[model samples]
Target: MSTLPLFPAVIIDFLGSATAIALSFLALRYSWSLIRLQPNNFIWGFLFYFCIAMAAFSLSRGVGHIIKILLIFGNRNDIWHLLSPFSGGINTMLMISAAAVTIYYHKGLQAYKAIRSEAEKLSEANTRLSNSAEQLQMLNTHLEEMVEKRTKNLSESEKKFRNFFENSKDIIYFCDNDGDITSINTSGRNLLGLDPGTTKVNFYDLFCHDSDLLKYLDELHHNGFVSDLEMECKGKDGPTRHILLTANAIYNEKGQMIGCEGIGKDMTRLKTITEQLINHEKMASVGQMAAGVAHEINTPLGIILGYTQLLMDDFDENSEDYSNLKVVERQTRACRRIVADLLKFSRQAESFKTSLDINLIIQEVLAVTEHTLNIHGVTVLRKFDQNLPMVFGDSEKLHQVFINLFNNAQYAMVEGGKIIIITSASKEEVVITVMDSGSGIPDAIKNKIFDPFFTTKDVGKGTGLGLSVSYGIIQEHGGTISVKSPVEHPETREPMQGSAFYIRLPATGVANHENEENLYNGGNTGIR
Candidate 1:
């Protein structure tokens, strides 16, 4: 029974050994392939080497078992027993190698995991850095745009300030504490008659009156500013101007006042207009009084003149009574003449209008006054424009105006002088200029010349109503009369500097057909 069991056991041991060897070799081949694909992988390397160790272990055991079986069958039991211990020792060494390889693989795997985690962290950091760089670039672009916008706004603000400074009509000026003008706008320079190249000027010098400057400075120092302070300033080339000034002190960053900034509004034209209105009102009141006085006094003066003439007729030519009566008559006639002039000045007399040729009226007046002008040693020069326009005025009244002007001219020229009569026409009016070479009207009395009872001649020589009456008549006739004294004349054959009377009359039409033939040739016609 023992020998039969031994036969089955030997067969079984051979099959088991062969199966273990085959499996070991297959594991080794697969592990080597895994290692070749990932030669540097710790896990793959460890697995390949461990498989080699297992295969060696299986080979040693299986070969030893196979040899023992053969030896036993060949009756070599002693040699089999001796080789069994060596094979077992070889198997034990291979098992130890496999365990060492497993431990090494575990350490290598931990290191590889750590390295991978660090690489992931580094990649995330790089991504954040890239994002920050993109953000910084965007911020820089936005900053540039904001800077450009601010610069553009500042430029526009400067341009606006420049435009206001240059074009403002009111005089804008800046002056230092010493009242030395440091900066002035274009209007200020023009108003003060300053040249563009002039850098500095004294503000006090512009004031017409020292009192005005003193008051301005006092108020400014006391109040830190001045508002609507009226002052008169002398112009470099024109009449004194009126200005309303407003000023404020200029300060630096330290709040210390360094200068003054001022604005002056020119009010000269308004002042002139206001004065004219007042003068007109005064003249109207004077005219009303004169009209009433003349109406009351005219009839009585005429009666006195008639009675004095009768008394003169009753007295003998050589008697003292006749002389007294003659003096009374002369005085009465003078009073009547004064009353008549007052009536004329008041425009109380009725006027008849006609299309009168101004040139013809001038000629008639010159013909009538020729002897008187010659006696006064005055010469008359006529420059009548051909086809002179007609004037819508009473012929007799205009004739009287020319006669009065001639008389005045004759008186003005005590010494021999020329009287220039020029007639010219424009589309709007006919202009008659009566210029005389004589003593010019004084500037002080120029404004008062047209006032009733205002006269420059000797008391008995003038009623002072001639010009006043002429003014009223011209006004009624829709004309304007202006005078320029000490008239400037270009160098000519005769450079006359005296007074010129410019009469502008609204034209009626072309010259009357009947007077057209009498229109003298347009040239200087001398009359003495």
Candidate 2:
């Protein structure tokens, strides 16, 4: 094989040079167009086409050299001779330079694209941030406006509350748990007779009498509120005024107690009017009773006077008939005793006496009525304490108490029931329990049983004043009467059962002695 290759090699080198130049120009044109396009699309499409064009050009040149060597020259000499070393070197240099330039241009373009894309992204991000900032500013403005509006409403509410609190007519005061006055409104200052600058006055010092102030304050501290509490306060003139106080407690948001506020109203005028009404009612009832009693006593007195006059005028002084006249005189004396009881009831008298045995008075009253109970078939059960001490009371009045109780018990039992009278003594008091197994008192009448002119009996059968007089008598003796009705069966717990009346009396001897000492010492000076 003749190595005649210089001419062909030159020609091949020229063709490869032409092809590389064409490829370089095409790549340059494509890159220029890509640069004019949008950054994202240009960068992506340029990278894809650059890789494909490099591979296609390399493959085409390699295959074309292989085909010439195999079919036309048939040996490695033809390849070396037809494709000159300088040609290949030049072609490799051109391809390498072109590829490097393409790569360099691609890298430079990519860097430029990255810079431009970053700038665009930054521009877009700045635009979004600006929009977000504006929206946030608007939201913050709206929130601030809402907060200001709420603050204004709260201020208005506080002003209204202050107005109401300051303008209230009631005497309102705020005090600490220790009963120290913390704040006093205008009405409260006037009520307490305190000037605005006064801070030395203790509320406890205003109590008219020494009382359970500490106990009352402790109750306020524990209960947090007090309603309808009645107390007496000494005014500036040293006269006491009655007051009704209603109080409420103040607490903080954390549920911690701060202080108590109280409103007090003067009740002195109402108390005076109530006392006057009570006295008027008593006077009216007494007048009516006095008229009836006067008539009752007048008839008995007329009969006694008529019989005494007949005896005095007709009977001889020394005769047996005169002894019979003495009997008439004794009967008249008994009639006078009855009239005396009626007068005692009609007139409110300080008939209290000393040195009386209450149990003995009860026995005497029972002796007078023993025949009556026996005739009525009512069994009397006596559980009297033999050691009952003597009481300082009017013997006749004490007798009347027992007579009234016994007669009521007898009247209650129309069918003949057992009457149990129990008398027990204590260190300070005596208890008398009168239990009757009779028709129990009705519920409707039980509360009014001791009230004046209250009775369930027929009009003629009772004067309706027995229980009332008994109550008055007991009250004067410093005793109490209470009734408990076990209106239910003990086992079944059913209703409408029997009742028991309990009378409690302070034992007369010791208490009366103490009372007399107190009276002598001016301790009882306040009694009206």
Candidate 3:
């Protein structure tokens, strides 16, 4: 054949090969889609085999034509006859095998139809028997109606119970065996701050602490119920919820414990009030004793200081008597300072709460301590929010709190270091952090820092009342003071860590503006 004719044959060969590949892919999709319908059926096997044979035959013929074209056009005569085949080729053999499978499948299909027809006849007979049974069942219509009436009554009772359940002020909840909230009332949902749209809520996530919840669950399982058990739960707002939880296991008719039902009475506000009252009484008792002791020592301290000064006047500056007199004077002076602190602690000074800028108080404390801090080579940085709202408290008392903190930070770093004073406000509270880049308070001593008479300073250096007094002042102001050590340095971000004192004062929002205005209008309690 001419090369021109061979090109046409070559084109046809490629087209046929492409067509075969496309057909094979279509066949694969059809077979898979039908896999669930008649899995491993004989008819399915027949169709699969037929598609495979057709794909192979078409591919082989197309390949042979291409080879023939190449051999004729490229002047390569070494392998010409191998690809040529007769009418009864390998494809024909494959078709014959597929035809045989198809015949076998036809037989199987006939048997299946026969079996299905027999099953239909059997089903028809069973239907007649079922009809007779139904007629007998019609005789008990009065019994079914009576059962329905009883069910309606029970449903009404359930409805009444549910109405009370949903309307109660106390939280009520139902949980599955896995401690998952299956259903909860609006009060329970609101208190727990649960997502109203969520269907399944994990029960333990509502609590302040996880380990406490686990212990309760274990106890409930052992006793089959828990009654008036006090537990702390996280609230929707900032404060923790103190709940008196009462719960019991719910069992099915077969005595299988499936879930639990519970009620939670919120006692957070009452508990806080009780705690504050107790703290006040304790402070009162301590203060009375402090006053008595302070009065008893102050007279003697004053006498000793006066006598030491007179003795020093009588001796020369180089004499041993003058040096000894100086020791007496120094010790007497120290004693007087301690006495003064005791008196201050004893008198719960009349602090009239008024709206005052906390930042201004902090700035005043900084102004007093700025020279001392600079002398000790300690740098002071301030980051106060400009729009910080005024807090309702005594400016003098808050001023004292910051003064104590500043003095402590100054002493903490003997060598040159940085101290950062940051004041920021959240939605509910104003936070002030005094951070010092000095020797960090170790974990062991951290907890005792605010305890009275607990000092890390040398014997003659510190009486350790500074932190304790600061703590008391903050607590009295309805605020919280906490210290965390080994915090990352704000500027350097180094491992040589520092100490941070965090004071959080509750913020009374825009409404407090009107309150402050009212206070100014009502009386002049020295806004200065």
Candidate 4:
């Protein structure tokens, strides 16, 4: 192989040596700068130092080439010598420039890395801020939902309160401390006959009498509540209504009086009913006492009438004394019958239970009433269903029920009417209906016809306990008794003409059969 050029070798050696020295100095400087940098920034900082060192080294090399050219002058014919050294120097400069370019590229890479790091940090901060914002937004949404829910709950509660305040049955009114009406319910408006939309009534002005208002207010203030204080209320109409007011004071949380609220219940009908009930009870008690006394007197009266009749028979028939004594005996016998009826009503007899064919029993009762019906000129119609099941009942009580109904029909038919007694059978019940065609019960007196001592008959004509005792006896037989009347006619379309009473008894094989037996045993059966 041909020997390599010495100058080129020398140029290569110098270039390599200079490169080594520059690299060493740059490495040291880079290490020093890196020592000052944060550990995270060390690598980028070292790269920057190396690039600056390389740039300085390229400049030095270019300057060194010019110095060498000025110091080493040679003959013109020895161009190779001059050109050769320059060529090496140029090559060294080129190498240094290339190294500087490499270093600049490295510095650029470091700057890019720094910018990227800053960008990364910014991105992380932005992500954190975005997450926080999202959380804040969710919190705001949750708070808003809570507020909406609370508002809805409050609205519903208000609606319920208003409903209760407006639709109450009692006459309700809210009054300010001055007793002026602040709010009134529909019932209150109705009670005062005030138009709900137009009339504005002051509560105090509704008092029938002026003297009662102050007294009521004072009572409410003193007691904080007043119940069942009865008074009169002036309605918009001409009439005044009796009312019972129950009032209470409204107080705030601090126990200070705020206003007054009152509930007025119309007591006019109730008071009348109470009075009637009281009178009925009193009459019933008096009837019972009278019955006991009459029972005691009946035995003596029977003895007296018996002796008087015997004495009258012994006397001459034409004697005036005998006629007088006959009259006395007849009147005494009538009084005895009345006393016996009173006793029958006052004392409820024990049911004498016996298995009886209901059809036979009804036939027997009709036979006994045949004479009476004939005398009243009332025709009797019997429609008995064949093969009716036998019923266990008190014969005496059942006889009494038939007797009372027959007699009532007889009395009702003063102008002569038809009486219908019908018996029908169903799957689980047996019904008996008694219909009268006389001027059926007057509407005004129909409800009270069964009440003790309540009779439409002239005094002494009726004991009045006939229907009542009959009602009690029938009820004790596990039977339901009800009355029905048409308010209007079917063919003529006029007002109803008569009433019918229906009695229903449970059939023998049903679950209620035992209830029938228990009822006949004089057990306390509730009202039918």
Global lDDT of each model?
0.83, 0.68, 0.76, 0.72
List, residue by residue over 1-528, the lDDT tens digit for candidate 1. Answer: 455569888999999999899999999999989888988676776777888888888888888889889999999989878988887888788888877877787778889889868888999999999999999889887988888999999999999988998899999888998899988899888887788898778988899888889988987787889989999987667667799999998778998878899999999889877876676677778789989998998888888888888887887999999998888888888888888888877888888997788888887787778777878887778777777777889887787777777777777888978888888888769999888888988877767777878888997999988888787778788888778888755225454567888889999776655664565653345533
In model 3, residue pairs whose N, Cα or C atoms come closer than 3 Å (at least 3 residues apart or on different chains), thus clashing, are none
Residue-wise lDDT of candidate 2 within 316-423, one digit each (tens)? 888888877777887676656545544555545568577765555665777788679879987776665555655656777778777888899888888787676666
RMSD of each: 10.0, 22.8, 32.1, 14.1
TM-score of 3: 0.46
Task: Rank the candidate models, highest lDDT first.
Answer: 1, 3, 4, 2
Query: Over 4 Å off in model 4, which ranges?
Result: 1-151, 162-225, 230-245, 249-295, 315-322, 348-351, 355-392, 409-413, 416-454, 471-528
Worst 10 residues of 2 by lDDT: 519-528
Clashing pairs in 4: none
Stretches of model 3 off by over 4 angstroms after superposition:
1-223, 231-245, 256-277, 348-364, 375-377, 385-399, 411-417, 423-433, 437-451, 454-458, 471-528
In model 4, the worst 10-residue window by lDDT is 519-528
Question: Positional deviation of 40 in candidate 2, in angstroms?
Answer: 24
TM-score of each: 0.67, 0.38, 0.46, 0.48
- Candidate 3 lDDT score relative to the true structure: 0.76
Best by lDDT: 1
Among all windows of 10 consecutive residues in model 3, the one with the lowest summed lDDT is 519-528
